[model samples]
Target: MSDRSYRFTHAITRKPAASIIAGLRAVDTGTPDLALMQAHHAAYIAALRATGATVIELDALDAYPDSVFVEDTALCLPSGAVTMRPGAPSRLGEAAEMAPHLEALYADVKRISGPDSFIEAGDILMTETEILVGRSARTNAAGIAELAALVAPWGETVREVHTPPGVLHFKTDCSLLDAETILATRRLSATGCFTGYRLIDVAEGEEAAANTIRFNDVVLMPAGFPRTRDALLAAGYDLREIGNSECAKLDGGMSCLSLRFTSKP
Candidate 1:
């Protein structure tokens, strides 16, 4: 088996700060309280670092408010980092903004082009043998095919999983906690998605728990999901609860806030 531990790279936003989607959409929306958002981001970073993994913080983007979610526009893989084509038009600039930073961190970088295809980082998950990609409104068949070709030589098979239309992102509804197990809400199974994989059910009130992040044997979950957290603890996993109040406002869960990478040695 391959031996590698997960690492994290995160960016803190300053302007047009993280806010609730409903608040952002409001006609007279006010600025998001930055102090609270920063505190939450700091706590999350600390928790990940506690796992004995590397933690790199991207310098704050003073100009772009939405740049905090660096994971949505690019994915870090064993081969290199892949710049994505965000499905949301409002988020298109994110890819371009992430290119320079990724280029500095990685020796090689690949991209998914526009007009013909699109792919989002959150729609992609990496396993030891293959890369599982989700085909959703944001990610197309052409994009998945191109990504597959890029990683094929590395002996990685790109499995395309279909996503239901209304879900915001694939990872939002279903998160690959590890190579063998996945945490998903009932909504995902109702659509007959993710064939061949074992699904761990998250209760109705604990649906948000499906968004937990797993690094090694430690799972970082959001606060207030005691039942789900307890279940995970009972399963012999260490659980850490962090407050994600600002992220929840934008329909983001623990998984969306950051992209994790496991380095194979």
Candidate 2:
């Protein structure tokens, strides 16, 4: 399998706005500190830039409290990009806001215009061979089907899977560590959705660490998960731990902070 799936040349991130305190969450942990969240956001962008990739820093969209979780706006692929129709009522406008940005970067960009379809990149994991989309409260069958049809002509295959009950997004429980290896929570891996791939189970109770991203040579994960950190180290992954306390309150993780992709015009 090609490493292009995780190897990115460019990334796009939005600064966390003060309104992020109102960002949607399955449960309210606490109000996010804008200053602290900005600090963490800076560190994240730095880590991505350290890989020698160009990082497009977009201005904050305060009107949308959940805009910082940019991954839900679209799926960026080698062949093209697709703007999603977010299920959350407040998040719906976020997708349209992201479309022009994607158009500027991608030569061919598409949109999930089905009125009833709803998909988020947070619920979609792209592999070297196929795109695995987990059905979640934020992503539905119609959205998955639309995505499949849009990418079919590009030689991409979409496989629908089940996200564990109450999971906010598919990636809330798993992430691709490499072309053939996956870092997943036992809760997600146990579903047998990844039978063919190598698995690295996150340490018990450290399931939040599953929502990590393998970018270039480094794997970025939220800080505070010592056991999961040690396991990834043992596996020889170059890991960078970033403070995520603030974003965590809003159910945001490393993968949610940015959209990583390589596009050629």
- Put down candidate 1 lDDT per residue, 1-265, tens digits, no spaces: 3523233333222222433332322123344556777888888888877777666676665554566676778877766777888777777877888788667766878887747778886777665556777888778898888778776765567888876666666776766666666778888767666566667777777776777777666788888877777777776667889987666665567766665664434
Give residue 70's error in model 1 in angstroms: 1.2
lDDT per model vs. reference: 0.68, 0.94
Give candidate 2's TM-score. 0.99
Best model per TM-score: 2
TM values, all candidates: 0.84, 0.99
Span of 10 residues, lowest total lDDT, candidate 1 = 20-29
Error of 1 at 17 (Å): 3.9
Off by over 4 Å in 1: 1-32, 262-265
* Best-matching candidate per lDDT: 2
Cα error of candidate 2 at position 86, Å: 0.4
Put down candidate 2 lDDT per residue, 1-265, tens digits, no spaces: 3787799999999999888888998998888999999999999999999998999999999999999999999999988999999989999999999999999988899999998999999999998989999999999999999999999999999999999999999999999999999999999999999989999999999989999999999999999999999999999999999999999998889999999998664
Collision pairs in model 1: 20-249
